[model samples]
Target: MDEDLMRALREDRGVKATALAKALGLSRVGIYEAVKRGEIQATRIGRRIVIPAHVARRLLGIEMEAA
Candidate 1:
């Protein structure tokens, strides 16, 4: 995983499941499974599902910024 890419995603509010899957080099189904397993947090906005940046950081074991 690219730290810079992850950081950029973290700086954003969230990312789409498909985009995140691409970023993590996993299939869309794999990302969905992670969401199902509670390894990542997701929110439904209209028809789109988004995963928050902080949650991704935590899952990837990246250091979080002070709140």
Candidate 2:
């Protein structure tokens, strides 16, 4: 992975499932459904399910501006 992208990933605290869903015009349940289907990578941080920034970026083919 790119070093700058990794750094940005760490800084951004990953993408929340709700945010990711909103970005894709998906329902939050749709995001969870994908996770259940092993289509997306995510982890639980307490009560929140977060998609790793790198995985999210790659899945969406998105690029984030460097800090």
TM-score of each: 0.63, 0.71
Q: Candidate 2 clashing pairs?
A: none
TM-score of 1: 0.63
Give the Å error, residue 7, model 1: 8.7
Best by the lDDT measure: 2
Residue lDDT tens for model 2, 1-67:
4454445465765878877776667899999999989899899889898898888777666677765
lDDT of 1 by residue, 24-57 (tens): 6889899988888887789878978788876666
Give the lDDT of residue 43 in candidate 2.
96
Each candidate's root-mean-square deviation in Å?
3.3, 6.0
Model 1, residue 28: distance off in Å is 0.8
